[model samples]
Target: MEFDTPVLDNHLHLDPENGRGMEAVQDFARSGGTHLLVVNKPSWTLGIDVDEPADFRAAFETTIDIVDEASELLGGRAWPVLGVHPGLVSHLTERGFTPDEAGELMQAGLDIATEYVPSEALALKSGRPHYDISADVWDASNRVLQHALALGAENDCAVQLHTEASEDLTEIADWATERDLPAHRVVKHYAGGRLVGPMPSVMSEKDRLAEAAERGEPFLMETDFIDDPERPGAVLGPKTVPRRVRWLLDEGFDDAVRTAHVETPRRVYGIETLG
Candidate 1:
């Protein structure tokens, strides 16, 4: 299982506040992973106060700080992917902000995140799934995502999105299309076989890999590792993608291995092909 290009784990959450965060990364690295692209979030706020506006504000700041901590932990071997996760918007509503107000706050946070684009961020990850949120709130989240896309457009950065895995990512692709963003710059995170745009973080399904390999454009891969000990390896582990991808490569899909594991990640997340 030799990779001609860097074997990058394109998406995972590493809790910079906890020691296990880097441990998870180190384990993956020891398993032949070259680098990782970590998305920053304060999931520790899970048991904390989401009902208090002040508490939520503090948690939000902590989320921002975690991105910095991650940059240091991976020692430039990893890059930070920052954005207002869709759950954060819903959480704001729980804290008493209206959907519109939460959208506004999401936009403001995205603006602040954009300032990190040239300094600390590798990319922006807008849109985290919102099945529990109301339709109006979901629409509001889309509005915030629009801001994030625009920010990426302005800064020449890439954006990986969180959304429903459905018939296709038509609506999201349309947003990027309407704004004239390059197709390669938009990533559909947590994606399945059906792709609507470039660089989907395709899940650990072999059929999905076969499907994506047939497509002309290269797709990215991810385990979407939540890294919570309470439900460890809920979706998949950090080593899953690299291990499975290695299998695909051994099965004679060197091209898919190169495209998904190498080119797509570099194009979408801006990581070099090697550490």
Candidate 2:
């Protein structure tokens, strides 16, 4: 299936667990996937203890290497989304690190991300339903989240948030509004039909997506493709987003396609795709 216009996949992971990262990029391109953002999976997902300095450094170095490689492999169609995942805060606290200590570690990760990723695509991923983080841990997560946002504001980049679409999202947007980076600077990473912030990169069914498109704000689209070998397209297939775009086109949702896939992503990430 080919697309008349380029399709942007807003979120994905392209490590070995994701299956031939370079090859996957090439395949996505052939399917008319012009742009994508690859995120570093949280430590809990990878079973690595990131509180350890060596592990943290090595993990981040490896993540940056993949992001760079993916960018090169796709000829700039790919960008890296790096920052401390909120889930890491949950994991660290479980491992007996104090909330403040976990927060400090996340701040260090953000510092490292700024050093490695020279753009606004730094992620402040937090608050997924899966993690049972304590209140103090949640506070720690917010501290790091604020730090990550500060980094994005300073760098003039977008912050991809892996948070639930709830009142907390409103607070995040309000917080950004008060800061140098406005609400749109926060890309609600893996969203659905229900919009919460000024910017939402959605991942939902066609009907719900159509509803979001009708509102006509600049909302992007993503498959949130996990790419875990064991879970094999747990969220969605690598080609799912592009195919969804095709569905939109076939269904005569051209404006929707342009807004979600082409324009919105380019606006947030500062990258262009084929028309």
Per-residue alpha-carbon lDDT of candidate 2 for residues 54-89, written as tens digits (9 for 90 to 100): 465555656666766666645336666776677777
Give model 1's TM-score versus the native structure. Answer: 0.85
- What are the lDDT scores of the predictions, listed in order? 0.70, 0.70
Q: What does candidate 2 score on TM?
A: 0.88
lDDT of 1 at 213: 72
What lDDT does model 2 reach? 0.70
TM-score each candidate.
0.85, 0.88
Question: Which stretches in model 1 have alpha-carbon errors above 4 Å?
Answer: 1-4, 42-76
Instruction: Summing lDDT over every window of 10 consecutive residues in candidate 2, give the lowest-scoring window.
Output: 120-129
After superposition on all C-alphas, the RMSD of every candidate to the true structure, in Å, is: 3.2, 2.7
**How much is 77 displaced in model 1, in angstroms?**
1.7
In angstroms, the error of model 2 at 131 is 4.6
Give per-residue CA lDDT, model 1, range 16-111, as digits (tens): 454367677766765567667777654334455344334334434454465555445442366777776777776677778899987887777677
Backbone collision count in every prediction?
Answer: 1, 2
Q: Largest TM-score belongs to which candidate? A: 2
